[model samples]
Target: MVLYADPRRLRVSAVAEEVANGCAELAKTFRGPGAFARGDQLVRASLSIVSNIAEACGRGTVPDFRRFLLHARGSTQEVLAQLRLVKPTTEEDRRLVRSLQSRTVLVLKMLNRLYGHPPPDR
Candidate 1:
């Protein structure tokens, strides 16, 4: 359980959730041909990151948690790749995409750190 409000858990979960929401929002903009598939993939991968983290929290062992974190890390990287493929037209879209990309990267880093150095209680 997250008894003490662990900052690592907070950052990983909160930021990953934000990334998922942002990716979902971004996906709606891709109504054009060829873009729909990419957007769908983006949403799936982004959502995976959050899902993995949540799964990690419910695990009984540190290794299990770290394993799920690694899964989340992979999903985060996929989101980054999808974000790279996005070619935003307007400044507003560009800002939104960039913000999502940056936040996704942050979540990846947080996942890596948490995986490498888990909490004392596991």
Candidate 2:
């Protein structure tokens, strides 16, 4: 049997860590004014996804969890939007954002399945 801990929860903690790391990596390459602001927004949106999921989990209700999942999905879209706004100067930054966006989509799909609905029409 698989042992489950709140901290080990895939949708909550694991994905959160992934987003945090991705954002941190992205933040390191900025070079001028507005860079910190842009980077902070990206990181905050990414972290929001995970934070909302955990918050919903603590509510201990399926509907609440589902609602939070929807919020996380919205935040995912926000990250994607911000990624599009920034022009990646390095191949590494481009690759990292692409990978992060792909994984985020997967997480959104899983959440949709868990919710028993089609992907949120975003």
Candidate 3:
């Protein structure tokens, strides 16, 4: 069966890709061991959002897609929560976190829309 109509054309896929890249950038800011470990967790959560979206699109059924979208939405929230826990030591770090936050929110909105839910208040 066909997976996605064309995953590349999906807005959620684009946003998820951006979120994963942003997580990689954010992960580079850590110095000590503990912070680095937390950064790793954040990166994993961020990438999970992307993977779940791709899996959703590949399911070839609306119900399956919505189930996976819920998982992606949860992952998006996880990334945002991780971002909130980070203490950015520089202006650049602060800006990066803000950008990631914005992108994650966009992904959340897209998933919500796809799942037939009302837009969430940001």
Candidate 4:
């Protein structure tokens, strides 16, 4: 539980949370007649991104952290795919999805950089 010394530590989690909030906004916006039933998975997956990153930071070893980072990246990709399938019924939905899509892409890129070349355990 000692990974947040750096001021930049909030990068990934912040973006992940943004994605989650975006999903929630979508769900709330479309609340009724299933409340965007397909979004259930989307929301959960976005949340996974945040949780995995947090889990990674809490791990006792670098390898475990890296592994959870990979999981976060996978969840990021899932969010992207779900965003693609989101049938926005309003301009607000379209805007939200577009914003979420870009942010999700950024988070994926961030995760890729974070764990793609982590230093070897030494």
Best by lDDT: 1
The residue pairs in collision within model 2 are: none
Better of 3 and 4 by lDDT: 3
lDDT (CA) per prediction: 0.83, 0.71, 0.83, 0.80
List pairs with backbone clashes in candidate 1. Answer: none
Q: Could you tell me which 10 consecutive residues in candidate 1 have the lowest summed lDDT?
A: 1-10
If the candidates were sorted by their lDDT against the true structure, best first, what order would they fall in? Answer: 1, 3, 4, 2
lDDT of 1 by residue, 45-65 (tens): 998998888888777777777
For 1-122, candidate 3 gives per-residue lDDT tens digits of 33343457778889899889989988988877697789899999988988887787677766677788899999999999998988889999999989989988999998888788421222
Residue-level lDDT tens digits of model 4 in 1-122: 33331213658788888789988778666555665676688889999999998888767666787888999999999999988977888897899999999999999988888786643343
TM-score of 1: 0.89
Off by over 4 Å in 4: 1-8, 31-36, 117-122
List the candidate numbers ranked by TM-score, top first: 1, 3, 4, 2
- Cα RMSD (angstroms) for every candidate in the order listed: 2.8, 6.1, 5.2, 3.3
Over 4 Å off, model 2: 1-7, 11-13, 117-122
Compute the lDDT for candidate 4: 0.80
Those runs of model 1 whose alpha carbons end farther than 4 Å from true positions after fitting are: 1-9
Better of 2 and 3 by TM-score: 3
Scored by TM-score, the top model is: 1
